[model samples]
Target: MSAQPESVTTPARSWFDSEDAPGRRDLETCIHCGLCLTACPTYRELKIEPDSPRGRLYLMRGLNEGRIAPSDPLVEHLDNCLGCRACETVCPAGVPYGRLLEETRGQLDRRRATRETPMRALGRWTLRHVVPRRERMHVIADLLRLGQWSPIAALMRSDWARRLLPPFAIQGFAMTPPLEPRDARSLERVAPRLPAGARMEATEAALVFLPAGTAKTRVWFFTSCVMEVMFPRVNHEAVRLLVLAGCRVEVPRAQTCCGALHAHAGLRREARVLARTNVAAFADAGYDFVVHDSAGCGATLRECGHLLDDGPDAERAARFAAITRDLSQVLAAVGLPDAPASLRSPRDPSRPLRVAYHDPCHLAHGQGVRAEPRALLRRLPGADVVDLANADWCCGSAGVYNLTHPVMADAQLEKKLDTVERAAPDVVVASNPGCLLHMRRGAAARGLDVRMAHIAEVLGEAYPAPEMARAPAR
Candidate 1:
């Protein structure tokens, strides 16, 4: 890791030249109140000034003022940040730390001239090329599924064999849920099982579900790429729950990845490209809201307004941003039916289902959706909900933070799991795919006898199909 070239000719304008780069105002807005320190995960874990929000702002300011170049040390400090946006929730100064950090990263990316490290190059290739395209992701998922059934599955789980694999690959394998076949991933395949005679129409453009009764509202469900591939059951449950809540649901097939990962990784141009594609995907949806089950995807979808402000389709981006809502928010807003009798605890009908809610950082800090999910959960028949200590803390699942910064991620994860164990809830609910996957792997690795589900899945349990309702408990 070398310092940025000091002797190189300065650019004609400011060193931060990219459109994605933050202006002086954003940097100046950080009043250095130190209010964000307690809320910052990295600062708490490392107890270092450089890892704190204020310190990072100082580095950004120094670079902006030409007092320091983008040294490897500076870059390392920036990269360590989780981008969880927890600081924003408590910042009295309203400093856009997440945006500033991203913009600064984008600036460095634009200025860099050295070749990328092989691992970085590979990561970029997958993020840019594979993850965004559904067909490519499916092909990769199919391959992974094949590996899971083959001898490679043993190799992946073997401690000795894991030592032979790249760290990222091992981390990736650990995070991935067992893959299901393509047919099993389709929402159409489960249409027959949707509650209450709901009618569903599927096409390459979108999947539309008409409620059994008159629709109170209509929304387009923003299915995330990773969620679609790795956690289709969550998506399916989300649709069924939405339809049951008196809303017609449409899932636009043309919609692509929300580009949260790209933007977080400083691929600004690529993120903007995906934003434009999504704007067009739901161009004619004409729905009340654009709903997403994954907190990360919803937060990123809402960012289109800022990410594509300079593009020609800025209005479309604005439209997309305006309607984007997390699944909990939408459900809370639209209201849900009274919990059915069957929704009570299976072990003892006299007691409520013991559920602990893990607030995904993006939903809690990004979308300000702390209460919606809990409110929905409490409404479940005989639901005994418990508060997770530091529920709003990042579960070390800030997008790919667990994979890239595993050590810090594990440290935060240890704290979170400790809290989970203390609560001893039957099920832990998370709204983001990353958090669900990361926490699920952690819980399983420790051999904790607890079930992990997306908020949608937990809520969906209350609205099982008629046939399922009659079936005796196993």
Candidate 2:
């Protein structure tokens, strides 16, 4: 008889085994093609092979094969990644880098022996308690608004403010006045259904618009925590525009924050709680679809269904996820409003304002929505929409990244600023709030006349308001 094949013993589990436990099909698909390396911001900055997507995959492989320990420097390289998901868009092998990194990070957090600390505790508390509660967040936002006009505002304006204050605080001043909260009756009265024979609403499922503070669209507005406390006009604009497109609008007061920040920061348990709360809040509304204007929130809600583990709630969670859509995607489906004849100009006419569009990572890379916003910008009168190099790159405001990894965050922001300066755009248009804040600070740091506005705000200016419907678009 031929000699029996040698028996092979399975290796003991390492810290990285948890990542493999979920199956590495996405990770194993990577062929080290180097395409993602070119797209990675961290790799571009460090020029270190180990920091690139391929490098990270190699390290993960080594750890799995028992060639490297979890405590190796390789772990630091993985931890340094912003989880921006930019690499995901460019990957030819279709690797799920974001999911892999998230799993890896989860493993890291669990394996670490460190006990609870004040900062970590504080972060958990704020994310769990403050962010999900609209009333509490509104109170804090009002306080910040008050501080903006107070003597403390002067302190906030100091050069050291950006360094000393939390990243959220640095960005909080951009919140505009809250929108007037409307009950369902008022929303129905203000934004009635369109006349018969208008563009047929998609019969697949009723599109539930969660207006994240823009009044442009007439669709059902969620009036989320931040939008209600801060950028109210955005939801108003969104509602107005939706109504213009012949959508049935509902302003549901029961809706709250989407819990994206909490989920991204490893507070998955808290995120699930918020998800359940939101699902219950909107459960009996009988809407066919759910939509969000904020890409960050929309993405979170879209994926929240997956976070529910083995329970009766999982089916309901999946149902909620099924209906979620980004506002841009919804608008793109509805088609753009007809640009008024007077608004059409042969050249930039209103002023010599050069506007640059920064594609928020959540909207562009995370959700693959790069064109609709740009198309909307192109229709604006006298708006010079210049495309900066690496326009789709993340601003390093990966949710709370600026707060937790300020140095790397600043480095990424500086690179972004350099690109913006080269393009010399007077105004920066970004889709997500995190990017807007980060870009605002970068511009302020350089004393550049580059103001930032949401895409909806910019579009709202191009369209005439309800009372001014007969007026020509500016």
Candidate 3:
């Protein structure tokens, strides 16, 4: 394939003019230590300076100085970056690489009216129209589910599948049952609630169960757009485990897509519009807290406030963001009251299942939620949590990077898969949907049997027998 075409627009006067204040500050903070170069997956894979964070920073500087146009090969190198922000973790100057990269990408999108190719256009169209629209995505997801059982599914088992229908095949393999529709009364009845005195005396509650008007204390679970349609079991188990932990859970009807896909893809206007809709949807839910299972959604929701320009909507966005928490962080803070008694002595006492935890770049580098998920995993009976080498390295699944930069993404993913395989773990647990999806595809491509699961699903397996009820709230 031809190299992506060079930019037609004139380069901005300076990085200062090209970027927002935060971007300029981050770019200025770069000490050029090259520490980030080693941690960057693309840099390591290609062994090219330009693919590294330091090299990309220089490119950004050049773009800002009008030394290179927005469509230059240098800019394309910047575009190929995974944006995993693993570089920021080790940056001695504490440069805000994540914010800087995002700002730069957003600015580039703004200046360029059209994409370079048809595939990019099609990808963006699907993400904006099909993925965000729950109905359309669900329809496609159902077809994928059926396809998994058909003879053509064997076609999906080949290397050609990776080249032909990569995204769909990946989704097909990770398929889980769709969420069960919940009514208002069932939500309240099944939700975990604080004891009357507990509610009155406590300064905080675990979560404000926002089941679409149902009284279930379990919560209003935001299964996420992709997780709901593709990997419902993760969200289902998350809800089941939370309810068992004495947290009321509800799946709020008002809860919608988290808009991370759109935001990351540079559809800022669409992202903000969705953010505003979500703000209004949950505005009066009267829940003490909002919990999300997917780390990607959790992080995006937490930053929804940033999506809005200055206005009342911006203030509301901030408020909504504050209440959202990741499932592991929330459960660890609150403590699970009714954890399975059997878990007191884990299942495989003789040889506790050796498991490796791949830290999703979003969870580790984006939200600083590194320890909580690990802590929760360690609590599982007979489970040995092994840390892979370079635990903070990106898995090359920075949102849709695998689709947009498949060659670079595959090289990075291959390295990650090698690390995990060498550890010889019985399973691999990752917190974010993107990580799980990307890792699973990589593992399958290599014919590896490392099981991939969300932290919530793993915890759910430990819930005591006589699974929790789904009663309507009184």
**TM-score of every model versus the real structure:** 0.93, 0.78, 0.80
- Score candidate 3 by lDDT: 0.68
- Tell me which of candidates 1 and 2 scores higher on TM-score: 1
Candidate 2 regions exceeding 4 Å error are 1-8, 14-22, 59-69, 72-75, 110-118, 157-224, 282-288, 340-354, 381-383, 466-474
lDDT of 3 by residue, 1-474 (tens): 776556544444663342232355567788888998888887877789998999988877776566766666756777778878788888899887766666666666666723567766776788778877877876776666666675757776667876777564355354333223323112232334322222211113223433232333433467688777666656656765665555656455665788887777666667777788778776755665677888788778887877664667987788888887888877887676544532221234557667788888877877788888888888877677888986677778778777667777777788888899889776778888888878887887789867777787666655632342232100
- Pick the winner on lDDT between candidates 1 and 2: 1
Q: For candidate 1, lDDT tens digit of each residue in 1-474?
A: 877675565543455664677878989998888988989999999999999999999998887766777778888899899999999999998888788887888778756722367776777899889989999999999998988885887788799867888787888887788888999888786588777668999877778999887999989988899898999878888888888888999888888999999888888888888999999988874688999988888888998998888879889889889999999888999998886654555566766778999989888888888888899998887679999999999889888888878999998998999999999887889988899888988998888877788887777677776654666222
Give the deviation of candidate 3 from the true structure as CA RMSD: 7.8
- After superposition, which runs of candidate 3 have C-alpha atoms over 4 Å from their true positions? 1-23, 113-115, 155-220, 341-350, 464-474
Least well predicted 10-residue stretch by lDDT in candidate 1: 465-474
Sliding window of 10 residues with minimal summed lDDT for model 3? 194-203
Clashes of 3: 36
Candidate 2 whole-model C-alpha lDDT, 0 to 1: 0.66
Candidate 3's TM-score reads: 0.80
Q: Candidate 2, after superposition: displacement of residue 251 in Å?
A: 3.9
Q: Each candidate: how many clashes?
A: 1, 28, 36
Question: Candidates ranked by lDDT, best first?
Answer: 1, 3, 2
Ranking by TM-score: 1, 3, 2
